[model samples]
Target: MKRKNVKLMMLAALFPMLCWAAGEQPISLGTPTGEIQGRVMLPDVERPPVVLIIAGSGPTDMDGNSLLGAVTLKNNSLKLLAEGLARRGIASLRYDKRGIASSAAAGKEEKDLRFDDYVADARGWIELLSEDSRFSGIFVVGHSEGSLIGMLASEGNAKVKGFVSIAGAGHPAYEIIETQMSNQPAEVRQLVKNINDSLRAGKAVNDVPVGLMALYRPSVQPYLMSWYRYDPREVVACLEQPVLLVQGDKDIQVSVGDAEALKAAQPQAELHLIENMNHVLKSCDTVDAGVQQATYTNPDLPVVEELLNVIEKFIKP
Candidate 1:
């Protein structure tokens, strides 16, 4: 279907003019440990602004697809965004996290990655991009949890010019998760509360329901704990580079409060709150569940032009 066509087109491009309009192509960044899987597209113009894209959490690929039900790779936001940027004379690099995408050891190791492992991989990419002459400078666009990784990789690093935090969490991650769960049905909310309480008490959450266990398991605990150790506000405050905050006013996952928190921490960061836009940066449906899930399946939907304009203007300056 649509996904197939897009992927085919992305891999078949030759000339640079419409290269960004093409689908996602495999990019290999040779790291110390091994090669990392990613997709890179350059604009038709030479020496375009290079933007590195980092995806959110849980099996998300370079294209912003997640394994969650009702969401597929077909609705990949980054895929279209990168392609759009290419058509606009911007270069981009988007990658699958270690063990995702086309990595040879994918299924086996993705489940075991630590937070530091992701940060190290990002650093490696930064180093590689810095050495390349085609790119003027690295501008990192991090979505959701990837924003944290981008900040971690760019702190005190002179190579990165700026950061675009899209749907990023400003407070502690667990706090945001807890807040969202608090409004769920009483049973679901209570179940999550109990599991969180157990974790906070230094006890294993094994007895929690299977639905909750998927998000709170031993394999993910190390990362959750590490994530709790730093606050996005604190991290952003330490970063000297320019930052742009992009948030969807209707996004149920991360609220405007998150963006406000970031702005308060870093007064210089630019904030762009797109009205009616959801977590995925697409036009949302008026209905409840429809809007939250629409962007996951509709690749034709484009991100808010206002947001893109802000980013382009910032990078150009």
Candidate 2:
């Protein structure tokens, strides 16, 4: 027991050195609401380009885990991506969105949360990176719903050198939701369409049905209204910085056609469609919904190698 204790002490003393060698550290940004918490992964190289990685929708933390009810979706996709970039001589900063994980104190009341609030937080991070001298350049990488947030944040920001969209939808949020609900019964689909139409018109839906209450709850309708106003293609087309659009053919949630549509919007942007890569950035052999969902909880599964390669080239090239 004495020998084991000594070894543990030695390992604890060496842990900081190991982290320094990998250039991993906790970072934070102060906002009017609260402090937004994040993790920064830097390479050993001097003045490396840093990418701000914005996570997808919901309660996704800095490491890409999402809490759905009692279940925690523990795919370390963003964490692995940051580590991979650090290994390739690039730096990255990934954060828990306001009101998520460590940054829970920064969350606003559900009724007061606007989509622009997220955009503001992302812009704050960009400004923070701009003031840091250790980074030679700043890039924005947005995944899923974050793609739209990053687009709005990077639109007129001169400090943002580039933007990358991964597994992003090309249309507005309402259209995407409509597509996802197409398999429901005609009555249900029509009900959803009516609710969406009301939200799209800048109206609050107060009389939500019991069956659809979870999705169209009163507190969340304001946020949905804000989210439905922007078309991603329109936003991406306005970006002055270089853009890279990446999509996976096997991504069950987002389609490759969405990336193509984004490319069509910005003719100068580069588009790469990776084969067999799923929404979580893992290479799944099949597109079975159950099989793809398994990757979401499997932290041991590493993200696709081509994802790292393409992102590295985009940032360094």
**Which candidate's TM-score is highest?**
2
| Residue lDDT tens for model 1, 186-257 | 998877767666655556555656777778876766566556666899999998999999888888778888
Residue 252 in model 2: lDDT: 90
lDDT of 2 by residue, 167-239 (tens): 9999999988889899999999999999999999988888899999989999999999999999999999999
- Which candidate achieves the best lDDT against the true structure? 2
Model 1 residue runs over 4 Å out of place are 1-25, 31-34, 69-73, 104-111, 184-211, 285-287
lDDT of 1 at 295: 66
Q: What lDDT does candidate 1 reach at residue 134? A: 68
Estimate the TM-score of every prediction: 0.82, 0.92
Whole-model lDDT per candidate: 0.78, 0.93
